[model samples]
Target: MTEKQVIYLDFKASKILLDGDFNAKLSDCGLAKLGPTNGNSHVTTSIIGTYGYVAPEYVATGDLYVKSDVYSFGVCCLNY
Candidate 1:
């Protein structure tokens, strides 16, 4: 996925689903936001997501970015 795509604001281990064929799928997109590709971020007033999986910058400033979801994906990978 590129930065121009949507960002899964609630990305976490619990939000992922693996099928019998090991196909990964993301769920619970109620907090997702559209990411910016011009080196900018999507800012919001509400900060909601699972602890330990949310990005530090997002937690500090409610700024959403594609990297935030990438951070959560990395954490999920570490669990396996």
Candidate 2:
């Protein structure tokens, strides 16, 4: 995903799944950004995203850091 900023604000089973080779792939990139990586976090005032998928810190402090995604991914992994 070169020149793209794809943050999985909505990470669910249907959005991420195993391919033919059993390789995980992301789909339905509804909020993908067209740019390269430059920072470790994204900022947002108004809260958005799925109920449990969104990180707690993000909701509390509005800091959309990479760790937040990790927490979201962990939620997916556990649910899956």
Candidate 3:
């Protein structure tokens, strides 16, 4: 985001798909927040997303950082 805050994106593999051109597409999940965060983070309460797809740190604690979304994306990519 434009401001200083962390985003915890729950990237569902069902929402992502490769087109005929083989380009990564968001499908129907809409555009995800993509930009530089300048090393910012945020925390949340409770778990509202996929369990194992999220980072372990976030699973143990509610502290969600920018890298948490990256970790989720990587996990989805690995499963892809």
Q: Pick the TM-score winner.
A: 1
The residue-by-residue lDDT of candidate 1 on 39-72, one tens digit each, is: 5656454788888888888899987766788888
- Give the top-scoring candidate (lDDT): 1
Candidates sorted by TM-score, best first: 1, 2, 3
Candidate 2 vs. true structure, TM-score: 0.68
- 1-72 in candidate 3: lDDT tens per residue? 256443535776876789999987765433233433445455555655677777788788866666777887
Q: C-alpha displacement of 30 in model 3, angstroms?
A: 9.9
lDDT of 2: 0.68
Candidate order by decreasing lDDT: 1, 2, 3
RMSD from true fold, candidate 1: 3.1
Q: Report the error of model 2 at residue 77, Å.
A: 2.1
For candidate 1, the lDDT comes to 0.78
lDDT of 2 by residue, 3-78 (tens): 5555566667768778799999888777543322466356454567788988898789865654456787788789
Model 3: pairs clashing at backbone N, Cα or C within 3 Å = none
